[model samples]
Target: MNRILMLLFMCMPVMLWAQRLPVHEKQKELQERMVEVSLSEIQERLSLTEMQISQLRPVYKQYQKKVARLNMQNHKLFNRMNADTLSDEQAKTILREYLDRERKLYALNKQYMDNLLEILSPQQVIKLYQSDSDIKRKIRMEYLRRTGKPKR
Candidate 1:
């Protein structure tokens, strides 16, 4: 009876959170939230001014959206992959598309770099990139800790 109560107490909040999953199925909102959090951290880390943030906002959002779309498309390509039955020509085509998207991402990132130059010191730009990965890592670590999951 004690063990049962302990288990129930431990799982109650998790169960409630699970029930809210559908309401939170807005992936775009989640993505935006993540970006906002990351941007806030970066802003704090680099001591960005109001004007700097105003300048960076639209460009950053565009970069995020483009990256998200590219990621989704790349994910779809792999989802359709079947190594056992894939023909050489099909493999070639997928590779070509992947490379093309990679080039696009490279150019897009370069554009973002150029845009940042207009509003941030080069050192601040580097810190902004670092803050992004740090925020993501912390979020992932918190999720793993809460779920009692091992690192993948």
Candidate 2:
């Protein structure tokens, strides 16, 4: 009885952790797939050489990870703002954090562009940016269409 209860307590955390492992792995796999798709689009739009693609892959992956982290932070801040009992100071703090994340995102974009310039022509870099925006817009439109939501 007592020993069985103790064993169950000991195994509970391990069981919970094992359950979480697949979810974490799935998230990682999705992120990798998104990065691959983005890279392929950029490569095709820029008409990148093999050498250029090799150079861009690492820089782009790091950029994507940092951007994802900052965006997650911003999403958390937005969720915090939705709390019904939020106070003025709390609201101000969340606003500041949100703006800080935005600035960091901008800095990340600038650094990514600087790195791209080293491997690509200015025109190619410009087209890459435009193509990225178009891709995002298309994704958003598709989401809206599937959800039957009107454009804001």
Candidate 3:
């Protein structure tokens, strides 16, 4: 009983990490696909000019990359906290960093959206916003179907 208990304790973190791997991969793929779809949909619906698309595309891509990086780091920190290896001070520092990145990304996205809106009509912006969620849901469902997992 003592040997079994010791083995279980030793393996617990590995088991937990294994479970998280699939979920993390799924989420990352979903997020990247959604961003791709969003940009295309916005371009199509707004009939964005070539110059506008060129300018806006890089802006979106840059911010998306930044958001993904920060989010991944945050997840790593959170997983450490979950494993009881992260100190309170470290967790607090990571949380603050995450929040700051989130706020900055939000502002950047908003600025890009505003620029696009200047190029697109109000109705087009509304349509783009509405379509975003629907597209993401569809992509997620399709992903789950392919992977044989229930949609989360």
Quote each prediction's TM-score.
0.79, 0.76, 0.60
| Cα lDDT tens digits for candidate 3, 1-152 | 99999999999999999999999999879777778778887788768778767776766677677767867777776665563667889778877887887787788778868875775677866776677667767777887999999766
- Against the true structure, candidate 3 reaches a TM-score of 0.60
- At residue 151, candidate 1 shows an lDDT of 100
Clashing pairs in 1: none
- On TM-score, the candidate that comes out on top is 1
Off by over 4 Å in 2: 1-18, 81-83, 137-152
Cα displacement (angstroms), candidate 2, residue 5, comes to 11
The Cα local distance difference test for each model comes to 0.89, 0.88, 0.76
Per-residue accuracy of model 1 over 54-108 as CA lDDT, tens digit each:
8888888899899989988999998977866889998998989999999999999
| C-alpha-based local distance difference test score of model 3 | 0.76
Candidate 3: list runs displaced more than 4 Å.
1-38, 45-56
| Per-residue lDDT of candidate 2, residues 97-131 (tens digit) | 88988999999999999999999899988898898
Q: What ranking emerges by lDDT with the best candidate at the front?
A: 1, 2, 3
lDDT of 1 at 20: 89
Q: Give the Å error, residue 55, model 3.
A: 5.2
Clashing pairs in model 3, backbone N/Cα/C closer than 3 A: none
Better of 1 and 3 by TM-score: 1
